[model samples]
Target: MDIDGADKQEEKPVKKAKVAAAQASASAESAAPYPDMALAQDIHRLTMIHAGKLSVDDATSITGTKPEDLLERVMLRVGAGSSKPFDDVIKENEEKYKAIEKEEGKDVSKVEAKEKEEQVDDSEEPLLNPELYRHLQSTLAYNSSSALSEDQLKTLAAHNESILAILAEGVTKAKEEAGDMEVLHATMEIARYQAKTGTKESALAAYENVLALPKLSVGKKLDGHLEMARVCSFWGDWRQMKDVLEKAQKIIASGGDWDRRNRLKAYQSLSNILVREFEPASKLLLGGIATFSCTELCEYPEYIMYAIITNLLFLKRTELKKNIIDGSEVLQVAKEIPVVLKLANTLYECDYKAYLHTIVDLQPHLVANRYLQPHSGYILRELHVLAFQQFLDSYQSVTLDSMAASFGVGTEFLDMQLSRFIAAGRLTAKIDKYGGVVETNRPDWKNARYQEMIQKGDLLLNRIQKLGRVVDL
Candidate 1:
């Protein structure tokens, strides 16, 4: 009996050991995120390093990130001088392992990076370009009260050419040597410089070269693609911006962490906004508002405004009240941008005339916005259509003169506006030109379903008739 009891005790310890081992293996397998979560969220886009032609004060007001702090972040990416290669900070990172499966016979995380040389004090292609840095430093002196003189612009154009020539030579050498790290470093130096001081077309070409680099990890490639989207966005090229964002999405699918996935969502939302895809844009923007760290894309306050505006367009009354009117996030920033708040409240309160007038005043803001300027025409059109629909919703038919007076617009002017929207099928209403009345026709799901069923029935009857003829033959 004593021997049997001792054996059972030994078996219990063995079982415990096995269970502990299983738990440890599971933890290691699920080591999804390697770096600190905070570190992952702090993505480095060109916005952090360059403010384009804006002086320090102007850039600060526009982006809400101080130029000096942006410069400091730039120093982190590169160093104070030629002490670092453009990509040494990332390339020299310790060996990283992700438990991601190989796809298409390529392990994205397995790309080999060359070790950093002990002495990189004078790399042929240093991360910092003194010429560009001087320009950025000088911008701070003027406080952005005036634009640059033509002579200064000409000097800068020449300066950028000289720097590009030097960077290109280094890139050529790295290509000849077949060093992956050197190639990446050299290429990024050119890309970063172009993004900072050159034209949008030049910056885009440089980023395309960066993405074309061989054997870069998916993460690195995504960074390049996202930056390209930003460049395209700043220049108001939605077509290219849309393409870049699509490419970034595919890279994320192969392998990505939580932070990068969310970053892509933010970029996509902006694209959707520009394209007038308000539904998806509203969802993403509103959900991401609280935790939005993509300050490189826009300021936090700007993000909140987009969320409110988009939701206002897409959401029903209950949802608008729940999410925007009463939501703490929207309320907190609403007062700061009184114009946007007034726009939202007027619409919610059914003050149609006031809403249209406020939006008229708001048109200049939209037109001047770097991101929304291109779509300002379509946006204004949509806002007018929405107001018309809401105003006509309560009546089966209303005289054109009465409708125009209600909106505080002239009868002839309102007639033209309603006629345009009606023709475009944007408004669920019709204008009776002879009767001088507007008649509402809100969509009915049952009517649509009935029409679909009749179409299907006709198709089935034709098919049966053909089968009967074949049988007769």
Candidate 2:
């Protein structure tokens, strides 16, 4: 029995040893790979160097990484470090600079150091044409003011040929420093010079530079885009004009009071492009007309007028003849114009009759006045007349329901016109306790000015209304 018990105890010890060996083998197979401690230390050292806590040389020595490699990595990760880190680097560099200065201590400050640094000559050297520089500086200063003399502008233009390159460089540096207002003013002066000299390319380049500036405010950006578009149009670059107008549209669509002028200018620019392109006018007209109508409804009559005129011209030329057989199509296009005119007259609170006459007479020159160009006027006027007619024939008394139903536009749009009319004393509204209107005054057809506006509007309306007339079937 003792011998048997000893054998079992020996077998148990052998079994335990085999089980321990198997467990060890399994752990070795399943264990994760160990990280490189040396590599981890190097990375930590680089991080410290990047944080400005250690010099690049010290970091390199400690981590055993090459100085160039370490610096490349550091720059890649931290983007050349902060200004404070740069200042530290400069301080570190100063000792080496000073050692060179001491070694070349033969009054080297007086001599221009070609080896390390170039000393600036503080001595006045007649300003390298002092008269010209003074003139350029004065021109810059004058342009910065609200009103500049014609002679001053002329002088600036004359001297611009000599100093424009220098001025552009200075402006670029100023923009980089966030002093872009001065640069903008200087660029405008330069643009004027370019325009006067008929240097369309230079003018466009200057305007484009202004547009590319990142730090400009939204208003300035809009102005730049509009100006650039105008310049591109003058250059007869329709594709570029389209691009600038599309960008301007994006800016206008993003709802803001500050953008009103931009929105107006953008719509006008787009209208000109469509007039010029004379293709796909319908899609452009329908897509943006609603937004522009809303703008007009919200008291932006000029913009509304612009949109209406553009769409009217587009439809008059494109859809009027083709879709004349369809009553709904004719009515749909016709209804949009009068609502726009009614809103414009109501909002501006001017004599609608006088305004209509002025518009008709001035229509030939409206494009010229707006864009300061003569070529675009005639086409713009034709379009304006077409829109005026459509509005007259489709005139449903400017009631809330009629206005909404006629345009197939939203109630908020009609309400905008109502609000503007009420404000202008042309409309009186009866509102409930919640500021919702119960009733509103209908436009008086008997008023002399109203009748005249309608009469003048009819002259234009007659042309468009003829499109909807019964054909001899």
Candidate 3:
């Protein structure tokens, strides 16, 4: 019995040892950290460390991983030892700055402004650290689809020409490794650079590339269409310009936050399109005026002047005064931009010379604008024709030389312009070159009125016949 009990005790020890080994194995399996999870956590930690949101050691503690591999991966260099508090460092530097300012006897704001100007200059071609650049490059290669952040895109958009070249090169290299979406994004940036520095054709081609991309967002597509229209307008391709504007309007009508901005652009473009043809422009101008809010018009006062002048030229001043000019909002704005007021006074007074001079004085400013450049010649011609027609209303006949002198143009040029109007049936006159005189061809209003009445009577008779048929049924 004693021997058996001793044997059982020995077996008991062996069983306990086995159980202990199993628990230790379980514990190790539970504590074993995954390499991938560690790498991800370390990446975020490294970012925080670089952004100054976390001290290196603090990030290390939160991550519970040795950061040697992470530091190498990010290619970041940390100053040895604990970092001084950021605010304290800034405060110390500011004190030194103030001391230097005191010695120079300069205003603090002026000094700060000067420093900011210098910073702005430096920002034009900011130098990226080699280590950091390499790190970002590798990151973009690996995560091509998510290569750039919003902040990064803004920075790239704002960078100066020299820096844009560098960024463009980097993005091009990244394209090989990037996915479709990333490639699209990079393509957009490349195109913007091309547009800013290259020819309109290249920029247009770039924008077209973006449009061709699959599954693009509506806002992006809308932006692309608008840009294409602008390029077309820039080169005076009216047909192409109208097509793209139609495309953009469809997108805007579909509805989004981009509605207001897109509508504004549409109106601005439409204004440019009708610049030479004011009569048709007057129709569209009303819609544009109704579409824009008071705040928006404030940003684009030029468009406001356009709307006002269009109505005035159409003899719809009473209506415009009722809806716009007399409105509290527009009246306040008009007080600031008096161009429309001056133009109205000149037109109302029937002072053709003053009107011509007013347009001439404002022509340099208006014609210099990107949208208005193409229409400057047209505006002048239209005004000249209107002035001539008005001046001729009271005259039975006028010598070409006398008319040209009054209008500040050559007699031959005036006669040629009149010939075009006469040929087009726009002017009721004939040139008698032998006498150097223009004779008015008065129309018989009584006969024309009788023809108009007969046509209206025919239309009324048809409508009455249709009503009789309905009553009989």
lDDT of 3 by residue, 156-259 (tens): 33433444454455445445554555555555654644543334466578678778888787766765665565445433355566677677778767764534
The lDDT for every candidate, in the order shown, is 0.59, 0.39, 0.49
Give the top-scoring candidate (TM-score): 1
Query: Which numbered prediction scores highest in lDDT against the true structure?
Result: 1
lDDT (Cα, tens digit) per residue for candidate 1, span 176-254: 7646766776677568667655556787899889888779988778777777777666444677889999999989899
> Which segments of candidate 3 are over 4 A away from where they belong?
1-187, 231-240, 250-277, 290-299, 308-317, 320-340, 351-353, 387-450, 456-473
Ten-residue region with minimum lDDT total, candidate 2: 3-12
Candidate 2 Cα outliers beyond 4 Å, as residue runs = 1-159, 169-180, 183-189, 196-198, 251-473
* Over 4 Å off, model 1: 1-187, 212-215, 275-283, 399-405, 410-412, 428-437, 447-473
Q: Which clashing pairs does model 1 show?
A: none
**RMSD for each of the candidates:** 17.3, 31.4, 28.2
Candidates 1 and 3: which is better by lDDT?
1
> What lDDT is reached at residue 419 by model 2?
57
Tens digit per residue, CA lDDT, model 2, 1-473: 11001111100111111111112122122111111111212333333343454455544443356644543332222111223343343344344334433333233223223422322211110111222223323422322222324453354344444455544554565456534565555455445334323344666776676677666766666656655654554433555666877787687576435334424443454445334543344344444433332221112223334444444445543443333223232234433235434433321332334444445433322321222122245543453333333433333333445434544556686466545545555444432325443354445657978889889999988877776674532
TM-score of 1: 0.58
- Model 3 TM-score on a 0 to 1 scale: 0.46
**Winner on lDDT (2 vs 3):** 3
